[model samples]
Target: MHVLETERLIVRQLRIEDAEFILELLNEPGFIQNIGDRGVRTVADAEQYILNGPVASYQQNGFGLWMVALKESGEPIGMGGLIKRDILEDVDIGYAFLHRFWGKGYAYEAALAVLHYGRDVIGLKRIVAITAPENPGSIRVLEKIGLRFVKMINLPGYDEESRFFEVDF
Candidate 1:
């Protein structure tokens, strides 16, 4: 399902057909360094991740990480949307783009759109975001989207602390 649109991007549901793109995005050095490796070493694994992660989330939770694509070419550039982590109290806005798409404002535009969807359509009251403490770029984006830094979080499986931020609707 197509969810939202920005001036330059289209945010939509992820499909099994997106495995190729997911494989590349998940293995990018920046994604591994900042978001951690998803261990998707093969295309099959990527398909499974799409099924179990985003597709399943959409079916069961009504929202998940959406594929962000260029409106002009319909080329997917990243993934972003509402994530319901078992460890978090509120839905978190999560996103990651291809390395080539960095520093281009797509993250901000996609995220800002998702946040609005979370509030206006999903009826969410509190939305949070987490990023590695050293990721200044992500921190800047989160802050730019109006989520205030709340604290450092050591989630159940993380080896290091993640900076947590939140915005209350």
Candidate 2:
């Protein structure tokens, strides 16, 4: 189902059929370096990831990372939406796009829409985000979408610290 829409993109739930794209995306060198490897080396693994991660989140939290696609072509270019992590105090927005689709303003557009949805639709009062210290692109997008840098902190199960950003409605 469509979760949010922009002039050029559509955000929606993930399904098992998206395994091929998930497999390719999870293995992208940039994705692994910035977003951490998801161990989705095969389409089957990607399917499980969708089922156990995003799909499960949808059922449990009413939202999760949804697929971001071009409205015109319906091609899955990325994924973006609200995430409720166990370790975080509040919901956070997350997104990742195939490197080929970077520099097109899609991240900012999709993120802004998701932020609004989290606040207006989901009734969330605050949204947070985290990125690797070296991920300037993500940092730029977070700042552009109105999240301010809060601090650098390490979360459990992660080796390195992440730059945290936040916004309140």
Candidate 3:
């Protein structure tokens, strides 16, 4: 189901049928490098990811990463939304888009919408984000969305420290 929309994009919940797109996206070199490999090697694995990740998040937290698609063509371009990581104290916003779609304003647009959703709709008092320390692109988007740099954090299970950012409602 559709969760949010921007002038140029539609943000919606992930469904099993999105396996193909998810498979390709999870395997993107950039995704693996920045977000870590999800080990989704097949469409079936993507299906499981949807069911176990986003779908489960929606049920458990009332919010999760949603698919970002071109508003006009309904073509999937990326995913963005709020994530509640157990390792973090506050809910955080997360997103990943295809490499082909990089350099566009979609990440910022979708992130802005999701940040508003977390505060205004979900009544969250604060939202945080963590990005690979070397990911300047993501850091730029986070700063653009009003999340200020807090510090570098070493999240559990990660090999490197992440640049932590946050915004208070």
Candidate 4:
């Protein structure tokens, strides 16, 4: 089902059929460098990741990471949506696009829409995001979407700290 739409992008739920796209996206160089290796090597692994990650989150939390597709071509360019993490106090927003699709303002556009949906539809009071300290691009997108840098956070299982940002409604 479609979750949200912007002027140029259509955000929707991830289906098992999207495993191929998920596999490709998960292994993209940009995704691995910024989001860490998720160890998804095969289509089956990608399917499992979808079932256990986004699909399950949607069923349990009513929201999770959704697919970011282009409105013109219906091509899956990335994944962006709200994530409810046990490690964080508030729901957070997470988004990533294929390297080829970067620098096109899609990330910021979809992020801005997700913020509005999270605030107006989901009625969330707070949303947060975390990125690697060296990822200037992600930081820029986060800041552009209205999340201000709060501090560096080291979640329980993560070894390295992340530059955390947050925005309150």
Candidate 5:
């Protein structure tokens, strides 16, 4: 995918150099409890995750999670983009950030950019987002980006309950 830039972020494909940041972000308490407990402990494990997850998704599906970076320092701060889920039956926008970046509108900024790209650049007919039913912050981000509530459903690859949201192009 081509690199996309916002005022404060640069959204691009994952690289091997990003392993440390990825591992750090994924192991955060909020990420473990809310997003899932993937347990990426080493740089090698994080590299494998980028290969098996985002890079593989892009090769197979034409889109996947983007590495979100701070524009000024060119440091990776998070990831936010679309993923084709085998169980969800659609391409869904997913995002996660370091705790330090929370409450600063970074999620909203990156998400809105991805949403626009999915519709205008990729020409997808629709896009979806799913969050744990209790994750009010994510739900608010979906709503803030203009996705409407679709329904409650069991999460794919997870045993938890989730609320699905979608927006049609």
Candidate 6:
């Protein structure tokens, strides 16, 4: 079920129908490099990705990445929501957008909405966000949402360096 909606965005569950858009967004050059290589080559693969990733998280954790859509056009722009990360042992806010939507504040808008939902609605005491040290843009979004830098840590199952940010409700 959809949990949150903003003026220009709707935060809802990732459906099988959203696979094609997920493929395109995950394959964006900046998304691949900055958000890690998802290898979402085909719509079928994207469907499985959503099932194994966000959908499973929702089933297990009660919260997961949401499909972010523009209300005016009803176009899926990206995803943003709370995720349970192995390193944090708690939920964290994560987001991604297509390259075409870069510099448009869509990420910020969607993320703020999700953050509030995770805190006030879901009753999460604290949420964390992890990003590559070099991805300043993602870090900025975390900051804009009131997350403060906590530390640098290597994520389990990931060899790359990552920075952790946190916010307490």
TM-score (C-alpha, index-matched) for candidate 2: 0.99
Per-model TM-score on C-alpha atoms: 0.99, 0.99, 0.98, 0.98, 0.96, 0.95
RMSD of 4: 0.8
lDDT of 5 by residue, 1-169 (tens): 4568899999999877788899999999879877898868999999999899989988998789989999999888899999888787768999999999899999999999999999888888999988887898898899999999989887548787788899988
- Candidate 2, residue 26: Cα displacement in angstroms equals 0.5
User: Could you give candidate 2's per-residue lDDT for residues 1-169 as a string of tens digits?
Assistant: 8898999999999999999999988999989999898899888899999999999999999999999999999999999999999999999999999999999999999999999999999999999999998999999999999999999999998889999999999
Question: Would you list the C-alpha lDDT of every candidate in the order shown?
Answer: 0.95, 0.95, 0.94, 0.93, 0.89, 0.88
> Which lDDT tens digits does candidate 4 get at residues 46-95?
99999999999999989999999999999999999999988998898999
RMSD of 6: 1.1
By how many angstroms RMSD does model 3 differ from the true structure?
A: 0.6
Ranking of all candidate structures by their lDDT, best first: 1, 2, 3, 4, 5, 6
- Where is the poorest 10-residue window by lDDT in model 6? 83-92
- Using lDDT as the yardstick, the better of models 4 and 5 is 4
Per-residue lDDT over 2-119 for candidate 6, one digit per residue giving the tens place of the 0 to 100 score: 8789988888999788899989988888787778788789999999999999899989988898899888998888888898867678788999998788798999999999988988
Give a tens-digit lDDT track for model 3, residues 1-169.
Answer: 9898988999999999999999999999999998999999999999999999999999999889999999999999999999998999999999999999999899999999999989999999999999998998899999999999999998899999998999987
Candidate 6, residue 103: how far the Cα is off, in Å: 1.2
Q: Residue 133 in candidate 6 has what lDDT?
A: 82
lDDT of 1 at 11: 96
RMSD of 1: 0.6
* Model 2: colliding residue pairs: none
* Of candidates 5 and 2, the better by TM-score: 2
lDDT of 3: 0.94
lDDT of candidate 1 over 25-142, digit per residue (tens): 9999999999998999999999999999999999999999999999999999999999999999899999999999899999999999999999999999999999998998899889
